[model samples]
Target: MKWYGASQRRGTLSRLAPDGKDVKAVTLYTHTFFLIEDGRSDEQKQPHYTAVGATPEEAEAMAFAVYQRAMDCNHAMQQKGPMLIECSHCGIQRRVLLPPAPPVAVTRKAERRFFNLF
Candidate 1:
């Protein structure tokens, strides 16, 4: 994504390719995984991953690390601050993107179109 007037990926800033084209990384991605207690069995609660990394893989690793560390004491619940990571390529580091906010309703039933259902 564009950041600070430069294209970036996984914390790395875009650099001019030999052909003068900007090199970009893969699109940032995220995944949801249920976090159970560090051990096995009996716990009915599962927490979903809420972290974003430069890449989906990175996001998972980072989020898991945070959860494991914060819950080291066997607490059932824990809160974590935003995770910050640096890119090895360009040093442009940042917190993962926050979850999108709910959209506001601007109009309701202005015109019910039959095709809209499809």
Candidate 2:
């Protein structure tokens, strides 16, 4: 499937300081696994997976494990799209060309056609 609004993967700019300063870290109450959704809206990406942790490190480790497990099974994955990764309290965008899922399987039923001639 094609992802829409690819440019809005990052967080909003208003959250930054007025003096054009970037904050290094933000307070995290609980570690969460959020999927960098495919959209260009002015909204933060929500967590799609059910993985959660008490700390950022723990959550990240779990996310990595999930990634590895997925890659292990998706042997037919194609290296085409850029995978967006979001860490705890950080809005830095990384451009890593990770392999996407395999193409969907399309099966059609075969129908026999009969023709009558005089």
Candidate 3:
């Protein structure tokens, strides 16, 4: 038995028999994901935004929309924190964090070369 995703958004769970035949199969319908989290303040009861979508791209789009809204509503001073994505089927979760900033380049003073031709 193996669980795999179909061409469409939904997934399919199929079982193979000894003769290489599909004995049983089940199609699991995909559900809309409602990912929400409070920014900066964990004590807040309400989340900063509620991102909803059935696919990952959709969810990201929704998140981006909310992000824009936050920027406009809060003068572009929105809090940044780790976001969570949970799987509705197996209850698996993953956290997305911001990457570290690039290192700064340090410039050194060039040593003066002596040109004495006495």
Worst 10 residues of 1 by lDDT: 1-10
Model 3: how far residue 83 lies from native, Å: 23
Candidate number achieving the greatest TM-score relative to the actual structure = 1
The digit string of per-residue lDDT tens for model 1 on 17-77 reads 3434655444455533333445533222333334565666786576555445543434333
- Give me the runs in candidate 1 sitting further than 4 Å from their true place: 1-26, 37-45, 76-118
| Order by TM-score, highest first | 1, 3, 2
Q: Candidate 2's residue-wise lDDT over 1-118, tens digit each?
A: 1222222111212222234464543333222233344543333444223334545565556645554443234223222335654332322222344578899999999866667432
- Write one digit per residue (lDDT tens) for candidate 3, span 1-118: 1112111122223344454554544332232222233333222222233344545556556555544444334222233335544333333233455678799999999877678533
Candidate 2 structure lDDT: 0.38
Model 1, C-alpha of 97: deviation from truth (Å):
27
- Give the 10-residue window scoring lowest on summed lDDT in candidate 2: 5-14
Better of 1 and 3 by lDDT: 1
lDDT value, candidate 3, whole model:
0.38
Q: Report the poorest 10 consecutive residues by lDDT, candidate 3.
A: 1-10
Overlapping backbone residue pairs in candidate 2 total 0
After superposition, which runs of candidate 3 have C-alpha atoms over 4 Å from their true positions? 1-40, 74-118
- Please provide TM-scores, in order, for all candidate models, with all chains considered together: 0.29, 0.25, 0.26
Give the clashing residue pairs of candidate 3, or none. Answer: none
